[model samples]
Target: MAISGGRIVIAFVNVIGLALLSCVADGAIQLAGRKHSLHIVRRPRGRNLAGGDPTVFNVMNFGAKTDDKTDNHGPFAQAWNAACQNIGPAKLVIPPGTYMAGQLYFQGPCKGSNPIIVEIQGTIKGTTDISEFQDDGWITFEYLDGLILTGGGTLDGQGAFAWKHNDCRKNINCQHLPKSLKIHRVNNSVIHDIKSVNPLGFHMFVTMSSNITVHHLDISAPADSPNTDGIHVSGSSFVDISHSKIGTGDDCISVGQGSTKVSISNILCGPGHGISVGSLGRTKGEGPVNGVLVKDCTLSQTTNGVRIKTFSKSTPNQASGIVFQDIVMDKVQNPILIDQNYGTSRKKAGKASSQSKVKISDVLYRNIRGSTNTSAAVSLSCSSVFPCERVELVDIDLVYDGTGSTKIVQNPTLSALCMNVKVKPGEHGLIVMEAKVSLGTL
Candidate 1:
């Protein structure tokens, strides 16, 4: 079920919010016209496990002190080793306390027969000092399957001081600071009920993984923190993210190239860049993105709301079957956008200045309503080289909040911009233009 060819049609007029249920059960999501279930990932049962009740391996037992100064890296590693190697089914617990941890790596492919649970009840604080991270990330859960990471605790990256060195916004060659949490090459995992706050870079990076469901997460950082994306998913598939409150400096949730069948719903995003699908197609041989559904989300005070951005002068690729529906914008800047001219200006693009090569197609924005702070609430600045095809905006009702700028346009509500994209007759709403798309007011 690689949802390619841009034929996926999933929509609902009214949506019901569903809580994250147990890991083994199929969580059926109720929608107005469709019922799509989040099939939680689970591997087959066999065993190196010691057939018994699950054992609890506490970090304190492995010489982890509950102080705020001593680095608990060794103790945490030892506990993960004991739990992954010694048990049929084990619970790795870090009890309630303030802990200073530097580069906590929970690498997996455990010998256990059953699922492994890493329950963190205390706060694990990261260093403001940049020399501590030898790897590219702080806390990494790599090469694991059937993991449950919960416990409502915080992975605090204490990034207020470290953000000064994060010059990726100004310097393109800046070495990125470590992300707070990285889930890489993992499968069949449920990460929920956690709070990840103030990372040096992205709060969570889910990359090269599949069959994962992430929900009930509260991720936040300063709105001005540079490059601090809340959750970034790249090169992954069959993922579901819902019921999260995310506010950060960068994208609250970003789906990059090679990602497919990603379902995002019930999110609260503000004080950051809104949920995005790109800034991609930079390098040659880059993969295409397809089968994305973003619905039932709310964006407030964000830079851009529900956008698909491809880099300028990009390589050849295609992005299709992307849907954004039932979204609410609360004083957002750009409530609906499709920018095919994104770039970092450290270096100039040379292929052609007029257009990009990435072909974007089959996008749907339906039932989106709210107020935007910007006068032009919608902008579809597609590429002139490849252009955009089969884009639709239906039932959109957005108005200017009258507080973004002092200089007001005569008709703010109908001030959407479109170029190099086509909306078929009887398949569009609001603004209508053949060559340059402008719409009627909501």
Candidate 2:
């Protein structure tokens, strides 16, 4: 009877364990089903059930081929036309597969009470033949307000062949290559969850737009590819770029002239020139770039980190109310740079002049700590004639890490070069006196 009781207890315990396991399995299945349902529900609806109408136009229904070789420009245009004409909120869907396309433009003040959504779930492969594109972008959306461009797909710019033909660096008259994506004069828009790779020129260009938000993007290209800026913003205001990873050859984020009230945060930049405010003042009669903020950024293995560059002999301009704070740099070349003589003429004058026409003032660099690969961790080559004023640096701690044989040893002990600028104590009253190295010999 004792052996029978023990056997009965063991059987009971096994049954309980099996029941627990079954319950766990059932819970997992239910969770997975809920997740799937959420995804389906989040997807753009084909029919407006509440309004009793169908407004979603799938590109495949208009004859877009999924085989990846056929050009889908015609079908895409057809679908765009139908969706743009829809009276209510409409969606243009590109289903999952590779679709080769040429230069396509979507121009709108789309006929809708609500914003139009372009949902891409597949790859849009750009044609390698550069002649097929007449403008500077492979795909462009122009004059569109209240647009929503969200996708989990890729925009592949086959730029390797065209990169060889690019001669913009050597010749000033070089033809401009096409950008992967360009949004011109578009306002109140959102671009999220997209991957842009290997563009012939810039990965994405935003110009003449306002109130734009770009987030959750993965932009990349080979480090050696020239002129492939991850994101270039010009003549735009009230723009925000956050939570993006950008690695490319040129500036990860280039804020051009006439850009104001811009905010950049939570960005990861590497294998490129880090976030740059200007290359401003290169042209005459340019407007002021003001009220820009770059914070909480990580730049690793980049050429420069947190830079503000302006031209010397250009028209008078002002770059003011700029802030760079809470940045982490890992082995960057120039961790902090404020060059007022950015693109000086190659013809050297008999006398050295530090006069820059650009008025760079009210710039702040705070809580910047990093290891710089160069000895001069902080370089401020401001203009002598129109000197930079009210430039403040607080809690900046950068170390030189170049100790190998191949490293250039010119001024290896130099920590900072402040030419002609006014340094003020920050809000925390933290300033580095030793970093104020006067380079009078330059």
Candidate 3:
């Protein structure tokens, strides 16, 4: 009824070997785990939630009054204050009803400081003129972190009345507009499962933040609506935007200056500027974007699908590690375009700078398939001084509905352009300038 010494020694050795193997597995997990570490929710440990944050916060406690004055922002503010006091992955719950609110300013950084989940069960209608919030700086989240905005509710930026009554309808430089949702210097924030329709200006503008994930969002402004971009990620890093449906007057997703480690996946966009990389030279003396990836996206009936734009007459900047792959386009006006002279109409006054310092390099587009409304499937307008270089295209196919020919407008120094170019009947490849062109079939 007793174990021998030899058996005990063997059991001890076996246990030590198992422990060593577990450590090896942990090492491998750490390498892959770093990418998924910046998630919205912190689970109990060893639970997988890839689509969204697994830690759910219920916002059903926040009551809504239907007959409440729409102009009074007090009830929601009080509720928000109470929710903020009850911290630790808490949700500012808005139950189903018409919740009338005004300019609600959230004063944070909060307790435990984990992301505060604001789940909208019903509509949170803004009361005052959205233009006034833009002018007066009403709703602004400054220097905060761990914030989540979820639920299938809309943040109505009631600017229709303001826009109709404004006197600067005919003026080009009307006024400095504000965005519906503005987050500045907030880190590790996630905005998911939300619909922001008809914002006053740009729907969401992320001025300075990092590790932001925007997923499963539906952003829309009218086709005739002006200055309403779906999502504008500026001056941020490590951003992942996926599962989004955007239709706006402006770009669906516009990556502005000082953004890096950006990935866009599984997006459907239309009636917009499509997915853009720049409009990158305006910054006086900052480095260009680095490590940008766009994959598994669709652009249907859009102005332009994939574009990398810079100014021809601006201070020299540089863009690197930009890639657009696995894209599908349908009835897009300009399926693919790269414009060096990316100035607004205001540039007609004069060149912003004497020479263009913006250097475009390592830009690659691959596996793009779809039909375009326009003939120019691919257009490159790189700067003369610092042109686009190291460009590659693999498995590029454009079927133009047998309607017209696809034209290729080249730049001065397209340093490298490689592709397997083909189109339907009556379609031909047109190159305005000389570049290294490789033609073959996939």
Candidate 4:
């Protein structure tokens, strides 16, 4: 007998009520007299939970073991298929236990109007061996819209062994290490209350996606771990990353080329390179970066804070309309850096004849107060050929504290350095630096 849609809703509510009561009374009900497993609450037949109830597809029912030894990739795939095929809202639940998994990819335009939710309650540990996964990441959720990935669980990359092979700095032909999590082409999604630890590469990589928000995430790796950027966004736009704690070796949040309209606020970054706008012009014909805002963020003991870097001798590129305001730094090496000759050889950059093709304009730094370990608080090493234009600094109070030491210190002074850059007064009608060029109100 086919149950009507209305009856299905009532049944679901009743079941949920009973389940809650049982949970309140004695924690969890045993399923089929199983010693350590909870009962699986099945939904009614022939009726979907589109707007009424959500079908729960527990991964354990599909032969996933909680011992953290067996590979649970097959069970996860099985559960995902069932959830994606459902005619309504569905949730794939990972219960409270440590589970070992190889790379798992969830790709979907689900069969329902509502979004699919992944409620992870247990730790998902990835394999240490790099050859286990085919892609450059452990878990990838792609081509899914209106998705929510939440729960107070951990994604453990166990990257201590893999970090030894990362030689990308010395060798240009290095193999890229696997990131912890990759979200590609997924729109209108939110990821919260998650922790990614010890990734061999970037902790979270978002590319070719839009309208996404990531909040309340704790991402960490060792300070010496190479290339472990906390969150890296490339070729994506309309993203918001807030209220997060990120500590790693590389940039806390790196906004790469072709990305625009990104907002990063209230971020706690430490023991890493601070937030950056670009290493743009690395390749020819790359797009520009615009409309980026980094405000209300704190950086402690970072190598650099609030940086904008571009390579020299690259194809023509432009970076404009960027702002970094109300940021606090502590014992940072370089509090504010705008290096247009980044990654260029010293011989090539110092030739006195080479000119950078990347144009930097309309950048403002306001209310940036902090203490720096080195004397040079602000280093504006702009290109000699195409100098930075319309640069403004207002209410910047950076002082040398004489507290710590770094390798990059070269007779530090409590002053700013401007090389081949033009200055302009900001909206407040003030220029803070004493450079050789004349400053004019914008």
Question: In lDDT terms, which candidate is top?
Answer: 1
Cα lDDT for residue 342, model 1?
79
Model 1, 390: alpha-carbon shift in Å? 0.8
lDDT score, candidate 2, position 350? 13
Report lDDT (CA) for all predictions.
0.77, 0.75, 0.62, 0.75
lDDT of 4 by residue, 121-140 (tens): 89999887788878787899
- Give model 1 RMSD, 1 decimal: 9.8
Model 1, runs deviating above 4 Å: 1-52, 344-351, 403-414, 423-442
Error at 17, model 2, angstroms: 61
What is the lDDT for 298 in model 4? Answer: 97
Worst 10 residues of 2 by lDDT: 29-38
lDDT of 2 by residue, 1-442 (tens): 0122111111111011111100111001000100100001112222222333438999999999989799999999999999988988788999889999999988897888677888888999999877798889899998787778887989999888888788876774477688999999988788999999988899999999988889999999988888899999999888889999999988999998998888899999998999999888766778789888898999988999999988666688888888888899887888888877665554531124535678887777767876666665677666666767666665565655554425755544534545566444333643323222121111
Which window of ten consecutive residues has the lowest lDDT sum in model 3? 26-35
Model 4 ranges off by over 4 Å: 1-52, 352-355, 404-412, 424-442
Q: Can you give the lDDT of residue 5 in candidate 4?
A: 19
| Better candidate number, 2 or 3, judged by TM-score | 2
Candidate 1 global CA lDDT score: 0.77
TM-score of the candidate numbered 1? 0.83
For model 1, which pairs clash?
49-88, 50-88, 430-440, 431-439, 431-440
